[model samples]
Structures are given as C-alpha cells and as structure tokens.
Target: MRNMLITGGAGFIGSNFCHYWAEKYPQDKVVVLDLLTYAGHRENIQSLENSTSFAFIQGDIGDQALVEKLFTEHQINCVIHFAAESHVDRSILGPDAFLQTNIMGTHTLLKVAKKFWLDAGVANHHFHHVSTDEVYGSLTEDAPAFTESTPFAPNSPYSASKAASDHLVRAYHHTYGLNVTTSNCSNNYGPYQDSEKLIPLIIQNILQGKALPIYGDGKNIRDWLYVEDHCRAIDLILHKGKIGEVYNVGGENEWRNIDIVNLICAKVDAAVVASPELLVRYPHTPCATSGDAKSLITYVKDRPGHDRRYAIDPGKCHAELGYHPVESFESGIVKTIHWLLHNQRETVNQ
Candidate 1:
C-alpha cells in the first residue's frame, strides 16, 4: 500500500486503527487528519508520535483544499475514511454538524480520491469507509444479522448520516470505478475509548461511586466487538478485500445493556477490593464491604428512535475475507475493566 491517509485517526476506532497500522507497517508512512472534536484526544497517540512514519495533523477532513494538498504532497494511495459525527444522542440535539462532517466531509474525500484513482500511475488506491450496523435500522428479537444486501433503513440522524456516506462511497465506485470497500460493524468497546460511551461510562461511574445512568430499563441489545479486533478486520479488508464490496465485522458477542453493566460492576467490585481507598471504606462500613457497584445503577428515559437489538452475522467477512474476531467479549471486557481501574487517576471524560 502507498501512503495511507486515515481521517479522524485520533478518535476511538480510528485511533486504534492508526496505532494498529503504524505498528504493523513500520516502514509505510501513515498520516492522520483529525478535527480534534470532543470525542478525539491527541494524547491517545502519544506513544506513536515519535515514529517518523506516522504524522498527525489537526484539521477537518471536509476541507477540500487541504484534502487535495495532502493527496498531492503525500501521494496518498489508501484512504481509511473514519471521520464522522457518531453520537446518536448528540445528533438528535444537533444534526447540522453531523450532516456537515459525515456527509459533506465524505463527499470531499471521495472527490479527492476519485481524482487520484482516475489518474493513478503505477499505484493502487482504495477508500475504506468505516460505518455502523445502525444503518440497517432496529432488528427484531428474532431477526437475523444484517448482510451486505440489507436495505438501508436508518432511523436516527446519526445512522441516516452514515447511510448517506455509505451511499456516496458506493456511487463513487460504480460511477467512477474508484476502488472502495465498506465495513458496517456493531458496537465497539475497549481501552482509550471516550468515557461518554456505554462501557467506559459505567466503568468510570462505578469507580467514583457515581450513579450509572441506564436508558429505558437498559434492555437494548448491542453486539460488542473489541476495538483491536475491529482494527484487524479492517486491515484484512484493506489488503485482500475485493473492490466495490461491503463487509460486516462483528464478534457475535451480544448482550443487553443492563446485563453488560451488571457484569462490569461485579468485575469492578471484585477488583476494587484490592484498591487502597476501597479497603479503607470496607473497614469503616461493614455493609459497604460488598463494594457493589450495581447499587448505583439508575435507569432513565430512552432517546428518540432507539434501535432495540442489533446482531451482525459477519459470515461474509468470516468466509470471504477470513476475518474473525480473535478476542472474545469475555476476555476483552476483563481487560477493559482493568485498564479503567488502573487509569482511574484521571477524572477525564475525554
């Protein structure tokens, strides 16, 4: 692969992919372009800053001029388009930013990549668009996972925007014959993820004795994939995937919202007994010795258009791409809980 330009490389999945690619291709030059939105933190890539092959730029991917300049200067042959407005609740509050970043930004990237691919000389080009399964709308309790042929039925503004971007990617490939591959993955949870998400938010609250907020009895189900495993799937698709095809990446680890939170609380409670502060609390209050984080859970109203259940089959990726998650959710969540407990010094929500 030639120069790889990964947009939103500082965000959760994008950042994880950046580190993964940087470590995997030590000699290949990788550049990251991020808008530094609330969800992104440059400090996430602190360890990789010293590598000459990796470069970081604080900018929006929607900037046409800057995008063109990067394509020209870096001779970027691969585009891992990850920049987008991802928060479903936030999108409900404010959709303009989502349309601007998710839809318009993708248009800008496709325009630039098309030019390069059409004029490609002794180089291969690909734009791998990262997306979510929410684009398939809410699945019923007995419904099967979404496949590549699943008709787009986005509900929330976030999924709608992502669907628009996915359409744009497909159009570029069909109309202009630009090499592009798309992946719609399920919910991802792991280390270095923003605290606003489900797992990290619950983990942070339990550590500080704060109320863990659950939406609408917390029965909504989501298939969780380890971020690193998602990164590996993206890598396989980028190299071996056929042009103009869509892939679904998931670990098949499905759990209800409250169930996952309760499991995390039990794990954290057992681990917190080893903590110095919690040991002191146990001596003062005999009942508190239980260290039950589950006591803090409080359910609230659900957001508008909440998808009840989403389970990705990932059979296409597994069979065609030979892509399967290496880390099970059990092992992944254990490691995630421990990382949060160790990094509890930060009161950061970033």
Candidate 2:
C-alpha cells in the first residue's frame, strides 16, 4: 500500500485527480495539500472527507518544514505535484504569485523530496510533475503538434514559470538521480472546473443570460482533454512511466474558441428546450422561448500573449505508457455543460 501526497488537490484538475485516486486505489492512502487559493475550493474535494483512505491539509507547498513533516508523518512514497498558479490571464496580471508558487514552491518540494526519499533511504519513491503544453508556445495551423522534443518557448508568465519548474525537476533527476517523470497536457474541461476557464465561463454565461465573451476573433485553437482522461494519464504515468522522461497528454481534439462557444450555445439551447422548466427558472436567458443562446456571443479584446494555437502529440504516451484520452471533445463538453447546469443552477437560484 503506497502513501501518496498530492499537492494542489483542491483545484480543477487536481481535485478530480484526488477523487479518482481515492476511488480507484482503495489500498492506498491519499493525502491532499492545498492552499485553497482563488482557483481552489474546499468543496471540490470535500466529498473525500467521507473516505477513510483520504485526508486533507490546508497549507502551502513552499512551507519546507510543513512539507518535510508530512513526508515523515505519512512515509510518503509517491508525490504528484500539481501545485502551481496556472491561469494565463492571472499570470499576465500578476506574475509574482506564479513565480513564487510554480518556481520556488516546486524547488522546495524537490529539495525536500530529495532529502527525504534519498537521504533518508526511503524506497519505492517517485515524483511526478504535472505540466502544460503552453510551455511549447503557439503552433501555426500547419505546424505539427508539440512533441516531447519540442523546445520551450513559453509566451505567458504562467507558462514561463511552469517551464522553469520543469527545468528544476529535470535538474534534480539528472543531478541527484531522483526518480521523476513529467507530463505536459493540453487544455482540460470537466466538472468542478473554475468558471474563469473558457468552457465553464461560456456555460455560466449561457445560463445567466449574460454575454458569452470570446477572445479576439475567436479563431484561436486549443486541444481539449477531458479532466478524467488527464487524471487517467497521470495515473498511468505515475505508475508506469520511465524515470527522467516527459510524456505529452492530449485529446487530439482541436477546436477553435468560437466553435466551442457555439457548440456550448447549441447544447445549452437544446437542453433548455427539452427541460422547459429550465427556461422558467432562467427566464432572462435568450432560450426562454425562441431566441438562440448564440445571440449572447460577444467578441472582446484578446489577452496579451494569447497563443494562436496549442496542440500536443501524445504518441509517446500512447506507445510507451499506454495512455490515450477516452473522452472526445463533443462528449466531454456535453458532460461539462450538464454538470454546470446542475451545480451552478443553484448559484443562479441563490
């Protein structure tokens, strides 16, 4: 039975991973450390409180003493580091938090892990760094998807900090022979995601009868991966990936921003038609009777350093670690919309 420490376990993808691990590996103990930042909500993984195999700690990963104490107390043999300031817009607005959390916090975790797992002679130890494909920068429509060999060209402060953390993890592996693996994944959309994200924001706007803001001309492309699929890929990599290797995880489903917005509009519109009571509740929404939700679409100024396109080549993950996203964008987006409609409907009602 392995004791696993998962950092940033209250955020979007991180919380989903925590629930996945708790449900899938009953023999293992899962410890979650989250600072409950703006992106992280305790309610995301609060359900884990019912599970005996799961535990939560409110703290920062940069706290060396706290991190080391948990290491010793739990005898943690596995670490899945997900703590980082991940929003590109937020990073553009203020980069200090990204640097402190992504770079310095990662360094502290690496140092403490190296000391605990190596110096203390802990066995069966593994460190997995979760990352993003934005570190490879944008891709032209004709350009091939980002492979593991792609050089780093992070455009935003968020991606830059993540790139630096990636380098630190690599340095530890090379300099100290720490058993570490990294996975760079594409965009993820699923339940419990922050509404600030593109998909969820569109869904929320559709439900609230607010404008669906599209960035720029809305032609920027992104490869979308379902959060569950990303969680599965991480699980596979943490267990089977080779040490000192980086794997790219993607859904291979690239969609333009406008297209996704339109799709969500269409789905939400159809759902309202089927459940007419939804219209009664959200009477102000365009779909109350005849109007289409797409009418709410409003193009706005794009954020600075917004990448034109991002795609990932997960061929290595599939061939080596047997990883492939199971949810298609169409299916995943539907699930996300349904989840938001149910959960956020309460918000609208309130």
lDDT of each: 0.86, 0.91
RMSD of each: 2.5, 1.2
Best model number under TM-score: 2
Which tens-of-lDDT digit does each residue in 1-350 have in candidate 2? 88999999999999999888888988899999999998899899988888888889999999999999999888898899998899999999999999999999999999999999888877579999999999999999999999999999999999999999999999999999899999999999999888888988888888778999998999999999999999999989887889999999999999999999999999999988788777787787788858999999999998898999999988999899888789999998889888887777346654
What are the models' TM-scores?
0.94, 0.97
What is the Å distance of residue 236 in model 1 from its true position?
0.8
Error of 2 at 147 (Å): 0.2
- Predicted structure 1, TM vs. truth: 0.94
Q: Which ten residues in a row have the lowest lDDT in candidate 1?
A: 279-288
Clashing pairs in 1: none
**Candidate 1 lDDT over residue span 232-265, tens digit each:** 9999998789999999999789999999988998
